[model samples]
Target chain A: MYRYDEFDRKFLAERVAQYRDQVRRRLAGQLSEDEFRSLRLMNGLYLQLHAYMLRISIPYGTLSSAQLRGLAEVARRWDKGYGHFTTRQNIQFNWIKLEETPDILAHLAAVQLHGIQTSGNSFRNITTDPFAGVAGDEIEDPRPYCEIVRQWAALHPEFSFLPRKFKIAINAADADRAAVKIHDLGLYLRRSDRGEIGFAVTVGGGLGRTPILAQTVRDFVPRRELLAYISACLRVYNQYGRRDNLFKSRIKILVQALGIEKMRQEVEDEYAAMGDEREALALPDEAVAAMQAQFAPPAYADAAGDDAELAQAAASEPDFARWIERNTRPHKQAGHASVVISLKPVGRPTGDCSASQMRTVADLADELSFGEVRVTHDQNLVLPHVRKSALYDLWLRLGAGDLATPNIGLASDIIACPGLDYCGLATARSIPVAQALAVHLAGREAAIGPLQIKISGCINACGHHHVGHIGILGLEKNGAESYQITVGGSDGEQAALGGIIGPAVAAHEITATVDRLIDAYLRLRRDGEQFPDTYRRVGLAPFKEALYVAR
Target chain B: MDDPTFKLVTGNRLRDGAVVYFASAGIWTPRIDDARLVEEKDGAALLAEAQAGPPPHPAVGPALIDAVRDGDRVVPATLREKIRASGPTVAYRAA
Candidate 1:
């Protein structure tokens, strides 16, 4: 829960006023649509298939109870009474009116939130693991570093208008839950020989029209020099990244064309030139301490009976036990755990929350999780701190809002983009596909074990299909909905892109094809093997044969 | 090759961003049945009129989409156009 200082609050107010005037002028016929479009996008408003979609930044996915309730109010009053949490850990109101966007932004600003940098070719939300601080495996809390980056990158004049939109993700844990390998810039926190924390930086990784894994440009840069080193990387990219062609403008393409070696040399030269400026760019020790203090761990009660009470609750209710098995994660603090609220019930659109559900979650957060909520990159919500003794009560409260599905990383927990349902850029519908898959896999996911199924309607890969253990990409081929299946992709520390299996499956056979693929894995896998591990051991031949070979 | 019988001009309303169709009497309608179906020859003119509405234009991204007469009613020929004319195919939380 990082606090916003006076400067942050004042700047946000000024930005809101500026956007309000922009909307007023546009509505008054003073500015053309072409002229107003970019201005609106700068403030995170986009005209979509049905209406304007307002993307609000959640800055590393942290949300307070007040902010959540404020979002619910906006959704109820102005737009549709629902908001979609995106894969980037941001929330979007799908039915915003252009005339009412300024007021919606104003409502968000009062809660210390805004749509700034959620759109446009600027630094989008700096994301990290939802369980960053509380996870038992974490090296350190990543939120303070994310906040530091947000303060530097938001409205940065130099890198704002880049070759393409930039994304940065940091993971400081043994597990890469933040999908670091699929971002423009990925940072893995590392410890030097003397126990000082630093960053292991990777550049050029992305999942979109052209999917590429990032290459490590530098093995380590001390925490103090993060800003200077990152500045040099962006400076080199800003200098040489292609702007002539829209499709080939991402830094990944630049990294590909110039080769990582040359790009590294260029970045190093830029860094060396900074000299004393690098020292100036270094974050002061006092500043770092202050930021760290802002994210200090929440106080926990000394529990006399934590697991004893939890074991009794589990013994009394099998459903609560199942949910605890599937949804709750271990916390670093004894007697506490992180609870994941599933937004992916069968036959529902992924990541959507009704206004009432938002309010309910807000209430539950205040009651159970110290008034804090975190949105996951996989489009789920996390109550990052909860007593193990209170798991049954939390489960019961979540069920009232239909958020108690016991599927977290299961196949039914699908990640699909809004697609043609609400998105203007989609070629085919992705939401229906995901919903259908979830329905098809309803009761069998637990038996099938952990599988990641991600769907993207277009090559933009907003749903991150390239990183799913089982990826489904929907495309419109010859005016008909067609789906392409890919296997063996993952977004963990050992990340790999999925390989497309055969030609695109017809729309009618997508789930059936998934069934066959899953069956193949179940039949061939060794004991205790997940889908990706089995695929890695055996490659694509077995699955390919099951999918394409004539019976 | 058999092609669509008529062209329908459509865009989203500038104010609320609602999907709208160019209708008779120089007005926009939210329903597809009220849309004015122009012949191929008149398609360009209809699209131009829709795109170049009076100051403080009522629509954005106006375009001519192919449609065909279904008995007395008209329907968009492409799946994309039809989905746009109606809302999303699946159920959603509507306000």
Candidate 2:
């Protein structure tokens, strides 16, 4: 949606040149590993377990079909013919070569894509609801504001190096699909009594060793002052956030120690000190209108045959009916629906889209949904503006590519991190655990109803196990893989951290343990009750009690 | 607490970041099978020597990891190292 202008093109070109030189220096022995590490990290080139992993940003999880094709080209040419979509709504190429990154980045620049701020202690990719502009409940499109922040934070000298990596998510919809609460800074658009748009900003909510929900600091800040207000919040954190201990360095830890009131006061004091600079940083009305124009709502055709065609298709193929029920959502446009192409096929690694699949989705985006794609934070791709009449055709094409898995909110739609399999920091394996759970739960997932299961290889919580209704955190215990389960975690507007239930189960027992937990939920749940609702009704006691029951 | 009788020095190849094991004659090989096994006595010394080289080493982040000879093959002791020696345990990218 938001195409890069000439200025953006020039800015990206210069950055690529710098990265190319840094990579060249490293390869030629002009720079040592220690010296080159930070530079490489800044460019999102990580030296993972088996090979280098290059994380490319999809700003606010939005992409054009052409950009999707460009990513496919990078995966096919330089990587292992596939890319892993991550929890941050970005894609990571796991098999990248250290020397080939510069060439790959240059290729990405051709399609207005780059890996900047996808890693390091910098402002990471700005994420938002996959159903951003299209969601029926949205107050306004948040993508324009997300784009604004992306430009402001990219390589900002003041925030280039924070205590640790920063994450920000903005949501305009009632449904918190972006997991806005579990970020360094979270923004929700609100309207004042005068009907002017403003932000309900939250600070210091994150998940790592210490997970905390973001506390609302500024209930409302006017639209024009958005940038200056956020700049002040970051300035406070930058000035006083911890730098001594690596584990205790996230803004959440700072917020925890200082308390929310003190932290709010500090940020407010910083805002007051900013004074005239705040006026200088104000977002103008013209700028807002310009951004809105770029993300303008697509022209919807008043197709008369949509309902009849959908009914006929559903009657013809029950599988298509199941898919429509699971993978599609209501749209703001009367004749349209937002389609989620499930990346988590049963028995496959979650979020690993093949080169051909990327190419196929890119083509499908153009053919069906206005040539745009949105990646979900839960490792799925969204065709955000699909016509209701085109739904059947979209399903047929997606099915052919094996992208039509009808398990959107079901147990099999797992979210997992690249754990010991790919990450050097992981103590235990996560991908295998996710695979096993997906395979075990596939046939009966429909019966289980809407559920969220997330897995992380370690406590870094990349898989966002902290928010899963059934969260599984993998750890190494006595030289063997062990998994700890949590219950009642949610990442929606009513955000929460999960509670651990008893001892960590051995690797072999994980699937069965999860099965028992689900069975417990089924037994305890009332009609139409989801996993989190059931968990809340019947606390962790019943789940814990059921976990180690005689099998 | 981490006393394994046998060990092998491992790192990633500089150019490609491929998992490599320290072999004989100051060479690094992608295959763990070709890795030269060092006893606990010589493991620290070999690791130090490999890590102390001048600018631009053949491999980076060299460290000693426990490994034992499983019949004719030099297999890594831990699952993490085993996964590193081979590729990811899960079949990804293809599907």
Model 2: CAPRI class: medium
Query: What is the TM-score of candidate 1?
Result: 0.98
For every model shown, what is its TM-score relative to the native structure? 0.98, 0.98
Per-residue lDDT over B36-84 for candidate 2, one digit per residue giving the tens place of the 0 to 100 score: 8888899888887777666678798999998877677888888899999
Q: For each candidate, what is the lDDT?
A: 0.89, 0.90
* TM-scores of chain B alone in all candidate structures, in the order given: 0.85, 0.86
Q: Supply the DockQ value of model 1.
A: 0.68
A249-299 in candidate 2: lDDT tens per residue? 899988999999999999999999998999999999999999999999887
- Give residue A275's error in model 2 in angstroms: 0.8
